[model samples]
Target: MATLARLQARSASVARQYYYRNSVVDVFRKKENDAAVKIQSWFRGCRVRAYIRYLHRAATVIQKRWRGYLGRQHYQLIVKLAYYTMKMNLYNAMAVRIQRRWRGYKIRKYCFNYYYLKAYLKAVSETNEAVREALEEFADMKEREERKADLEKEEKKRDYQARKTHYLLSTKQIPGVYNSPFRKEPDPRELRLQKAKPLTHPRPKVTPKRSASLRNWLECTRARSFPRSAVLPPIDRKPCQGPFRDIAEVLAQRYKPLEPTLRVAEPIDGPKEARAELQRQEWTRNVQDKLFLPFSSYHKSKKHIPAMHLSSKYGPDSYGSQHFREKNPERWICDKDFQTVLPSFDLFSEYGKLYSKAGQIV
Candidate 1:
């Protein structure tokens, strides 16, 4: 029974505590606190909320102070403007009043002076006419004298211009001498320097000599430092240009035709051999075709002549293994007159070809 009683007491105490915690006033207070906490949480934390509130207060204070300052400045500006406007109005009024008084004075003075001048002019009319006539006569005389002086000066200027410098130099002096306005007379006792000599000889009467001009007398001058190379050698570029056309034809008869090589040629003695030789000759007829041989004068695929032929080659010979050069310098300049001239090479090759062990055609 005592344990049951104790349990009942604990239950009643729990019920009372629950009722107290869940009361209407407490619920309202808790709701208000939750709302405040929610706002604080939205600001990141309690510290952040306090900082934001403080900054808001500070900014409001600063804005209020700034508005007040602006109001004070505006008031001051308005007061200054009003004062300046008043001052300007007062100055304008004073100037207007002074101008009125000055106008009245000027009108009075003008009226009085007009009368005085009219009476004075009426009194001196005859005297003024006489003075004017005298002045006109004096002006006319002065004008006539001035015109005569100007004419005399013009005549003197023209005479000076017409005078020759040669005559001045020969006479050694100027007549009716006037003091020079710019040129001061030389002091009689001052030390004097001699006149300077002429800058160069008088302008040449004859033209100067030029080397390249056909009409000029000048020619290629001999350079003593390089005497050997300075010799005037006849530069005959083309042998067939001037006088060697007929001579070449006549000299060509003197030289013997060069021997042929056995790079592509074949001989036959029998009927079957002749038929094979004819077929071989027909196949080699195409000059564009490149065949491997002992030597070729040109490249296989290009129109350009290859340097291999220009070099000294011991190419094959028909009669014997005779060595020969593709380009002989003695025959290059004038070979038509030579006795041992080589046969002319064809556009592609008559006998010249590339040497290959396989003897394949490309």
Candidate 2:
């Protein structure tokens, strides 16, 4: 009996343990299923909300487009209405203008003419008989005055003719020199009087030496440092072998001419050198022409005639002349510096253009 009881108790404990474990597993499974169900419901809800939002956005876009279309239609309608109204107003104003002009023309042409004619007729018909008699008397008086003027003119003409005929029939006497009443007759001896010879006086002849004596004396008396012969003695120095002619020569030799690397083609002393060369050539040409050319050739070559004296104030190429500086400041003659000096430029040259570049003239 003891053994059976122990076995039955052990079986009952095992059954209870199994029942507890099964209940615990069931509780855990139900909780997991509930959580899964909740998550699925939340996901579905989110999808539905997203779809609703999408529908709202699509509807908003459609509504905006519809509103824009309607607004555009309204705007077009308003524009058409305004255009038609403006056209109608313009036509009406034109019609009114035409009507006004037509009415004014009709009134002026018909009514003014009729009124003027009526006034004129009334004045003519209301005229008095006394005025007509007075006008007739005035006309008769004018006729009588005209007739009197005509008779006076005829009398004057007859008197002129009678005077002319009487003068023509009368005899005229001409006065002779001997019988003239204006002057007494000259004596016969005075008429034969001989013309006396002009009085003679001798004029002393003057010598050139006498006239220039004072000038020569003054020149002799003036002081001098040395004899005139020693003052202008010619030098035998060769070209480019003398002392420096100007500070420019020194600068030219010191600062080399600009190379072709730069756009500026000339150096600082280039203009000075060019001007000096031009002056030297001009002087040489003038000297040659004066020595070799005939006197008649001077007129043609007179452009480079040597000046008697050099200007003391300004250099040959300087432009500080008071006469032209103010009048033409931009002209090369009026420039303060000799920057515009060109070696080969000539105002009289015919075989050149007004502008030149790179040996090509345009």
Candidate 3:
């Protein structure tokens, strides 16, 4: 019985240990499964975070690209609008100018016709008045001549009667001498009488009808408008007198030309050299007279004219005169001569295009 009881206790102990080991393994398995689930959850969270970050980055890039595209499109639209506006303005200005020119033409025609008729009538009236005055002076001279002739006749009649009475009374007393009193021998002091004729002054000649008429017309007419102050004086400008005459005489003497001499320089070796030398000499000579002479030769052999070399010295400014520049500053004179000598340049090309556009607008 003791042996049987000991074997039973040993079997019970083995079974209890096996049960305890099985329970411990189940608990460990449950713990491992919980840890795996936590790890999977962490991986899913990380994947979601990575996806969100990628989406944010992609959205930012798309927004920037869209903004840039819109900006560029807006700029292009603005430029197109400005260009159309400028073109419209230019067309309107040209239309206005054409209308103004037409109106000016009509007004000028009316003014010229009205003044011409008025001037002609005034000239005719002045001529008539001058003729009337000349006729009156001639009539007065004829009347004076008739009165003087009547007075001379009366004096001669009185002298003849007195001489006849004295001759009749003294004839018998002086028979041998035969001194007749009618012949004025009775009184020596009153023997002969002399009469003087009246003197008449000459009348001035009347002026020609055409000359007087034109003069009156010009004086009555209004002066025409001109753009510049350097205008010619009236056609009736008279010779200066007194102090003004002296001043004019002095100026004439001062401005008189002095003796001039022309001397040729040595002949150049080539046609180009000769032309260059001639231009330089001509420029020097003209400087003394305060004149500027631009040299341009069409000769095939002559290539060194100052015009050909203009780009080297004065750049594009040498294209035209200062007056042309003042009127159209944006326009440049572009020629073969200018382009050939001009240095290769990007800045000038851009500027030249802008200038050409502005020139076309003007």
Pairs that clash in candidate 2:
none
Show where candidate 2 strays beyond 4 Å. 1-21, 112-362
lDDT of the structure predicted as candidate 1: 0.58
Model 3, 1-362: lDDT tens digits are 99889989799888999999999999899899999999999999999999999999999999999999999999999999999999999999999999899888977866557767788999998898999888888888877887787777766665564444343333334532234445645443233222222233479999865332224323325443211243333456565432332323333343445532221132223444766888899788773753343364545345434656663665556346532323333465652112122233555334412323322311
Report model 1's TM-score to 2 decimal places: 0.22
Compose the digit string of candidate 2's lDDT tens values, residues 125-205: 668666898899999999999999999998666555544333223113743222344658743322222112223457889
Clashing pairs in 1: 293-354, 293-355, 295-353, 296-353
Error at 222, model 2, angstroms: 99
lDDT of 1 by residue, 1-362 (tens): 99999988899888988898788568599789999999878867768879999999999999999999999999999999999999999999999999999999988877567778888988799789999999999999999999999999986664444342212221135422232335476422111111212123368688875333222212225332222332342345333332322323322332326545433243223434776888899878867665444436555455553486665446664344432334356666674322343444574453333323543221
Error of 3 at 344 (Å): 99
What TM-score would each prediction reach against the true structure?
0.22, 0.26, 0.25
Candidate 2 to truth, TM:
0.26
Model 3 Cα shift for residue 303 (angstroms): 99
lDDT (C-alpha, whole model) for all candidates: 0.58, 0.61, 0.58
